[model samples]
Target: MYFLVMKMRSSRNILPLLSTMIQRTCKFSALPELTKDRYPNVKRGNYSQIDTKHLNFFKDLLGETRVITDENECLGYNTDWIKANRGYSRCVLKPKSTDEVAAILKFCNENLLAVCPQGGNTGLVGGSVPVFDEIVLSTSLMNRIISLDETSGVLTCEAGCILENLEKYLDEHRLIMPLDLGAKGSCQIGGNVSTNAGGLRLLRYGNLQGTVLGLEAVTANGQILDCMSTLKKDNTGFHLKHLFIGSEGSLGLVTKVSIQCPPKPKAVNLAFLGLESFDKILMVFKRCKHELGEILSSCEAIDADSLAATTDNLNLKSPLEKFPFYMVIETHGSDNGHDEEKLNRFLSSLMEDGTVEDGIATNEPSKMNAVWQLRERITEGLIHDGYVFKYDLSLPLENFYSLVGIMKERVGKDAVRVSGYGHVGDGNVHLNVAVKEFSADVLNKIEPFIYEYTSKLRGSISAEHGIGFRKTKYMHYSKSKEAIDLMKSIKKMMDPKGILNPYKVLPQ
Candidate 1:
């Protein structure tokens, strides 16, 4: 099927197609419904007293096959990928089309039933999962590529479409998504927009605010805001779509997304560099950024403990025999010869200056993936080894690596296993505190201890990850009172009833 999307340049309105077309289809409910089964194992309190009259209306409107209330069927949607936070719901609504979403929201608004929209549920912040037994409006059924314009380099798809599927589809067309993450296979486009996810590619492509052209969302009052325009320059009043980009589903449920695509690089190079001290690591980043210029896509760092975790737990061999810090640098460009020559020259210069202890990578894909796996698998492997207190913070390059030393000192050299790593170019670091087990007393001390030092460094407690329930209290440390008040005002304006993903991103 083909769709000729004529996007308006002056307004938020988007023209889908003059004629209807079939793209892709999945088996799931189209609206809300009720069933005989209840979520007995859910941690939240019972929702049996809540009226399902409006939910029943949408069930009849969407059809029984679309809405699911079976105990086994609803369990999968109840929890996110982390499984750290889980909630119960009597029904799971799977709306396929915008009209169905509108109808469901209208009924929900009338009945005053709490609603939580979820995507791939791979969120680390637990924003995609419910803390209460709210009706989960699962977007899984709405996976479909509505349209793609090669000329404009714009792609539009439904909210539930997985990130990996979008990458594959774009690859087939010789295009690529502007952003990518480790959970690309399971994370959905809508979730990415909701969280404003920052991945490895953010160094080159920037954040979701830059890549996302427009969005279509169903607000709390059942209003359909379609601003899926592909215009490169739109001087519209508010740019309302930005409101939902990082609002974490508290503002509205993202039904569809229109993103700007970048051309696939002709040549890509990845190298793993071992460094002795934090000072030299920053030197390497500076030299690479200046020398490689536009070809330098990313520069990520991994400390010794992270290296040990990945090597021991994930069984990934260490690239260097001994190094306090390791860096994964990537360069992508249109010309293979030019990119390779620039990268080699940069590394050669670094070697002469003693900035990089050891550097390796010959532009081979397999080897590159292997080097990246060291950083990517570290977090995943920590889950099996011990209880991890994860923190993603943004700090100055000078102050970044010192965190490792401070954390180890405070937590004790052996009592706590701390690792610091992340996209160095972006000044975002991912530090994991691995302890044998977790207890309330230990957690209370550990959480605030880390946050206090982080606040001293002027670093964010949660850099890319949104302030979900887990980190809501710590948000005050990062955000200003006025800024936070504005966010609360916006949330109140969009969801006056406070039924959309309540008790999240803000402290009551």
Candidate 2:
């Protein structure tokens, strides 16, 4: 037996890859089937459809350039990132300021017209797009940075600011956004806050619930609710900002956001390891916490099938030789020497016990990023494989990988491949199933089974991805009847008419 470690050549940033993915998602052969037709059970609400009067009102308020009625241009805004959901909205409104958003929502509410608050249109579920003829209220034009307190690192920016753009701006000031995602290239800050996005860095920096300080939202009636508090500790009557944090834009449209950023780490390091089994991966995670402790920024596990998908579909080469499992571990700290030493020691201990079959460690920016691409680009690569059924789950580590094997057995031969990968540090697992094409029979075998099994193990069916249009029916598995009822009450109170993002998040 021989030990084989990999050393990869330096490459440019991840922009080329991100650009390719964005291009692929934008070009559609023909528009996807309308949501209303795809799921006939979902009846359109008794709301006024967009008429000439409505379009004229919007045109007068925001000028013709701001109000988009051209069908060809509106097509891009009507579909989701995965092209899984498409709406039949004939109009898309681009509001440049909070006052404009307020006016649009207020007018729509008064006219009894339902509206969908859209941002970047990168949502995994069908939450961002309209179901029927709801007017598309887009926030892409509200992009402006209100202010940045260098001392406290509190950044207040309009909701339309892109995530990658925010990170770049923060880098110059020695600070960074607490949460990051693969979709950061195109996902908007407002949408990130609305969905409460938890990405690769949640292992160290925590979720948006802690990172986001406050936000300003407009209700269905168009009332501006400003909860923009910069202070970390605000003992007010109610932390009202939370109501919209993960509401998925069903309650209201997020206009602006205030988030607390952490100082950028002076040093960073990554270790890519090859493992033999799931039990060994668990053992490594426990030892990892004990050894790496405070410096560990991320710990991700990708199975052989997942790695193959990236290499085969995306033409990306694996750094190391074939292995049953692969792990990407990263650390961020103030001292370079100290952090690298800790990581090296941790890898040494695992290798001594043969827990890690092979490994490569580095602090070089380009090489580290090249490895990061392997993990971040998995979602994009799988799309090229076939029709993908994605599940975001959180389960006890003891049985984390059990469901993947169970699914492969359950789906049998219809499935082209069943792969699992995600943040092990936090217990969120992304299980993706790829088939040649969509089949109701395959879907029937997958869905209720995945949710039921997750409930049986006392796991969350939706770990970080909030309950959007796709998972509304499965809410019962995760929430009690009382909980769901209470949620409905809150929806009624916040958005009485259900004008904002109808047929999403809440079950009928």
Candidate 3:
């Protein structure tokens, strides 16, 4: 009986071992092999590699426990959020304070070592991860809320604080951060400020450039430039904080941020409308603006392809019959009764005029959230559909949905799905093309042509997502030579060694 029991226990252990082996093999095999060689223009810099002395210096600066040298632990930092970009960094340095960040940059600069400053590592572009063996200076441990003023609604916090945590903290005080995104749970405020992330709330609160009152950043030479102000109005010289707002960490590393937070609305209402065409979507947006007015916090649009993908992947049925286009309009106000009255009135007018095929409006928290899930879950669903080539652009309102059709015709059979959805309130459309896998031929058909189409319309190639390495070569599509030259000059002046986020934001 004892022998039999031993045999069973051994069998159980062996089964798990076999399972683990199979998982590890599959995981490793699934990992895409993209190295610096793929980007032939980005040659390794002259910066020295990590050595024992360098490791000891970091260990001494930020205790041994904070320096992660294990290859497995560093893997998470080396890979981007989309798993499209991978790096080969050997170590990740987690610093707890602004002083630690300053000291690390100083040491790396003096040692001629390349460094990549990382926040929550939630960036969609390849900006957060390193291309080669650059040491990762992570701000994950520097998360601390410095202060919150109940009177002025100004909240100051460290750079690494998660967006959702900040929102929760503000909820207790009846305030709301001016930004909201799908990745709020994992994306850090520093990265948001770095990328100038414009999410669902931008249509209501404006961009971060206006909401961010002040910032504190560390230069490549280790100088701590502190402009941390909490005042709503400041006529400071040059407004240096604006430089780092959307710089994408190419010039300096943002260590602290002071932003203007608005009061949390007491009542929130959402209307999910199914329309027959993009023309109706635009008409609804204008009517909502005129009717809902100040209470209209968000006006987002989704095409049939996007809705179909969301329904297929999430298994969530649309509240109304599927149409060629869908619009999710949200209203926020101090009184639920007034907000709902306005939303209902607008919906009634739309339905009576035959502008909307079907629609649903709800103020109950559960039902309202169910409506939002359809729009917010589109990004997650796209990942499962296949590899997504996402393009966020600002175009003339009339020319917004045209590009999606143009691209569909261009790619034809190569693309599995071509969908369009975005913040229609602000004229930003997220054009996503899903394919079974990445293909150079597909990319060639989409590029220069799309940029040309947007440029001719006098629209921006990148609306919210910054010009990371992926879009560096296309800067000319949106900016003039003189503008790009000034950017290059500023980069050279700030980081002479080009050690901070090398081969990014600017073309080679």
Best by TM-score: 2
Return the TM-score for each candidate structure. Answer: 0.87, 0.94, 0.93
**Model 3 misses residue 477 by how many Å?**
0.9
What global local distance difference test value does model 2 have? 0.86
What order do candidates take by lDDT, descending? 2, 3, 1
lDDT of 1 by residue, 1-508 (tens): 1111222223334221121133112111122121112222223322233456755776798788878888678877766544445666768888888888888877776667777788888777667766767888888889999999998889999999999899999988888998888888888999999999999889899999988989999999889999887887898898998999988888889999999999888888877777788888888888777788788888898888787776666566755555788888888789887877777777777777667667676677677777777777777767644556677888878888777777777677434478888889899988777765543454565677777777888888877878765677677788889988998898888888777877678766
**Candidate 2 residue lDDT tens string, 1-508:** 1122532222222121112222223122345688787778999899998889998999999999988889888888888777678887899999999999999999998999999888988887788888787899999989899999999999999999999999999999999999889888999999999999999999899999898888999998999999999999998798899899999998889999999999999988888888889899899999889999999899999998898777767767666766789999988899988987788878887877678877788888878877888898887778766677889999988878888999999899998889999988889899988876666788889989999999999999888888888899999998999999999999999888889888889788
Q: Please count the clashing residue pairs in each candidate, in the order shown.
A: 2, 0, 0
Q: After superposition, which runs of candidate 3 have C-alpha atoms over 4 Å from their true positions?
A: 1-29
Q: What's the residue-level lDDT of 303 in candidate 3?
A: 95
User: Tens digits of per-residue lDDT for model 3 on 1-508?
Assistant: 0000011111122111011111111112244456476566678878898899999999999899999999999999998766667889999999999999899998888888888889888777688889888899998888999999999999999999999999999999999999998888998999999999999979899999999999999999898999998888889678899899999889899999999999999988887777779999999998888888999899999998897766776666666654678898888899987777777778887877788766677777777777677888787777766677889899988888999999999999999899999999999999998877767799889988888999999999899988777788888989999999999999989999887988778887
Model 2 alpha-carbon miss at residue 395, Å: 1.1
True-structure RMSD, every candidate: 12.4, 4.7, 10.6
The candidate 1 region of ten consecutive residues with least summed lDDT is 27-36
